[model samples]
Target: MAEDNPKSSVMKAGVDDAKWYWLAEGWAPGGHIREVDFDAQMRGIDPLFEGIKIVDCDTHFTEPADLWTSHAPAGMKDKMPHVRRIDGADQWFVGDKHFGSIGGNVIAKDRNKLLGRLAFQNYDQIDPGSYLVAPRLAQMDAMGVWAQICFQNGGVTQVGSLLGLGDEPLAVAITEIYNDACKERMDASGGRINGMGTLPYWDKDLMNQEMRRIADMGLKGITLPDRPERVDSSSAYVGPDGKVSPFWAEVFEICNDQGIPLNYHLNASLDANSAIWDNLGFDQKLPIHALLHHVGCAATLSNFMVSGILDTYPKLKIGLIESGMGWVPFWLEAMEHQLDEFRTRENRGLKLRPKEYFKQHFWVSYWFEDYAPKHMLEEIGVDRVMFETDYPHPTSLYPGVQDKLVETLGQHDYATRKRVLQDNAAELYNLEI
Candidate 1:
């Protein structure tokens, strides 16, 4: 919006709130708020180029405080985290750490001193300004992200971790607040950035109400936990009389009837007690999630397939976000192996291979994991896999993400590259631009 100087243009995203830089104060690695030199970023180091187009499949925004304080029915807000005074503003405190504040753990943590060597710290010379893009076009120019589907912060709106909220009703309220905040953010973006809403996992009545609201608000889709603890309805747990958990049937029906897609985002943890604590051992925090993501997806998907949900609702589409591609081949093989064993039976309503349902009814998004094996394209099917820069997170490839991918899988030819970076996501999200 100014001269060629990227500094003057650093924070202004066409307008005052156009860019939502969650890591501005240094949540991301290699970030030092006091020393951020936008001009230097464009001039000396990695310059923000204008040609690359990135659709950041994963990004984040601080969830609104009112989501818990106002939306939580009755005394439930008291159980959830309350806004604490920090740096002259009320902020949410989870596990006794402040969020949505300039001085919070994620925003201002010492990136260089972590126990596990972080990628951002490793690439310390890179500047945060070089990664700045808030206005859709500016974002496109900054990180080459043509589009971004963002998530919500604060513990309650923090996906599967909602189990910490203690009950279904409060969890539903937290989700409602998250959706409302997302609607406002999407409106502010003027459709340039699509916002993903959180779902009310427990109560069917509330879930349906919010689903309808999300549709009317023009949001792209809703992100819910893979486990049943955070979700209500009949599917909260495995039991014959479990509140008619087929509620997902209703959700699927709504999405199908309304032409909306449902995104299943992995949360911090499946166990509520352990999710809030960060010091649950390196193995607990990182390695466990690594294993659980695949296990969770496989389990839920298998259940959905065998429970006759897919057969009952063939038109519904589900997105498996942030789960890596390595599991694709193994899981597909396992499912088909089972189907091969069962196909000759008469009551088998399913007529296609397990892989067919995946190709037809589901989508998978991959983080820029360097070891994306050579035959990954053949294993996961290039058209169904989308590339994502999990920006600001530990795994994010911001500042130099695309180049990393190019280095990893660039030799695969133009078609493979295009499919991994652009075409796949465009098709998955139904993006016209």
Candidate 2:
């Protein structure tokens, strides 16, 4: 008998490419859209897969440009990207130049049709109908991905930038709207598609309300940016117990109480490596693109450990999404060294080893590369590593993801491969389907 998760027998019941598939709740679309030429684009990555099962953990889509103006309150709508139809019912562009810049900056376009048109603009045009979910699914079916965990793209826009938006009330409203939309549109798709909720990192009360609302809506996890706008990694504030930053305390309490795992979706912009490009004064894209996700991944794990968050909440299970595993072993080792060398007044009360606490408390998603050291299992523990396809994005191997996993773990026993691909995620997400 075949497995239960994919439910291949009922194609429409789970996820199929026949119709338009919206991956994330908020609008942030870009990367390998189907209406474009895929054959030439996929040639580079497809060679890796002869036979494999694929599961995508991170992928994104642009939001409908007019979301804020349509769904937001009247006072706030004026502040959103202004939209007006031009040539036909489907044609429109951002009207307010200033706010339009925000929308355009977010999606790189004003009109959805133009956006759709641009999805194919880079390559020879292919009919959107010709290839999309069907080929994508065919690839997955070939590879044997039981399921995937999809996250929002546009949702990450302005999470930290909201600091510059000038109104606390409006910022909180934006966060609530985006999150509620995630639950309604993304998670509601049921099994094949899994959605992550966003939190208001700046406001503690709003964070409390949003967590409750997301849990009630059945979202499995929440996504926080690698760099929060206002809070520094080293800053400490007293909590309800008159300790530092109750936000984390409340986060743990809410997640533990409600069974939601907190996911840190790594972005590619916050690393100091990108600063090298900045000092030379060229576009930051070179280093920004290179170091973004990996560095953020390293920083997030490092921050939680060095700042005593892991020791503070031993039971918390944090998921570092879209961050590949190559850097983790080194980062953890560095933390272990720091713990030993800096056993000074600043580190007085900490009780446990940083690496021990991290392995017990956190999980990371690996994609594209899996050349981890043999001692990785001994250091971070294999149970803490999971798999991701990053589907449809330029980096995604889609059809061949499992082939990579099998190849990487060829020396290992069957059980290890199975756990990394399926069992680990099943336990991490608490996926019943």
Candidate 3:
């Protein structure tokens, strides 16, 4: 009778016998593992803003490894970017050159473990929310954010990497594939996410085509390299000639006419490298390098302000993304002082000071910054400043972000706080909110 009782025998087999069953059911000793419902969690929490919606001007989205190859045309499939293991680590390769590892692009969850390390070297080590739109939306809800303007992950989004292929057709095709993928994510996000499209900025014809393509896809803006010369070494936008090229002027005109803003993100230029810090002591390099990253966007802004581009296309909107606001007051003061001293001598054509143009045609985003708003808001004006979380990045405001924002922004009057948290970005991006 005992031998015939198979069910009883199985129950008597003990913990070891039940291990596979528990694992299959996603069960742990304490409880069953399950996906968190962020939307549900958000319902119990009070609103951060009384009545205004919060719009994050700068957030990031990681592109999956298959984003290009999976969507590539048959002729271009062989040339599309794909991942391969090199020295036991997964690396992104376009043709022969290795771009970077998958790990650095999705560092949100593994940030603690990656304090001094380069990257996690595998997809499994990253947070799913970093690469998936649905998960990202949930994460946004959990953080009390309503909508975000998404930029591509640097490791994969490099215009320099795309141009290094030395294949114009391939580069343009890859960019289109990336834009299409971004548009797909935006479409799926139900107005909660907007993607800034990437362009093959080296070619004027291609840039024009891609800009129109992005607009058709309903994207709000286009991202240009922080250093234009880094994208194309011979780019007319820069050089010792010190004159704005007709090509770039035309491009600006297109953006102005199309109502698309040009977004310049920190380190968007691929020129800077850790190799420059080799001369410094190892202990001092990282900290010093991190300190200087904020200057890139400012440098880009100065270039446009002095180039007379702003004067030419007064209607064109430009945003400096992920660079904090603390440096702006000093930087603008210096620019104004220089313009006053040199405008007549150099025959620099400008009607207003650098700071004036900044307040009118330019916008800057801040995250993890408390001092800038306190000190510079009066000078910079509340309308030109926007807020961002840089979500899913290592330094991102997460978990308690709403509390953090409230603490930082609580002192301002409600209308002023509303502009910083929501209205500025809404108007700049032409967001429905």
TM-score of each: 0.69, 0.68, 0.82
Arrange candidates, best lDDT first: 3, 1, 2
Error of 1 at 295 (Å): 2.5
What is candidate 2's local distance difference test score?
0.52
Clashes of 1: 10
Alpha-carbon lDDT, every model: 0.53, 0.52, 0.68
Q: Pick the candidate with the highest TM-score.
A: 3
For model 1, how does the per-residue alpha-carbon lDDT over 179-214 read when each residue is reduced to its tens digit? Answer: 766666556655546668766654556767887788
lDDT of 2 at 351: 63
What does candidate 3's lDDT look like per residue over 108-222, in tens digits?
Answer: 3432223333334456665677778887787776667888998876355566566666787887888898889878887798777888888877777788788778887888788
TM-score attained by model 1: 0.69
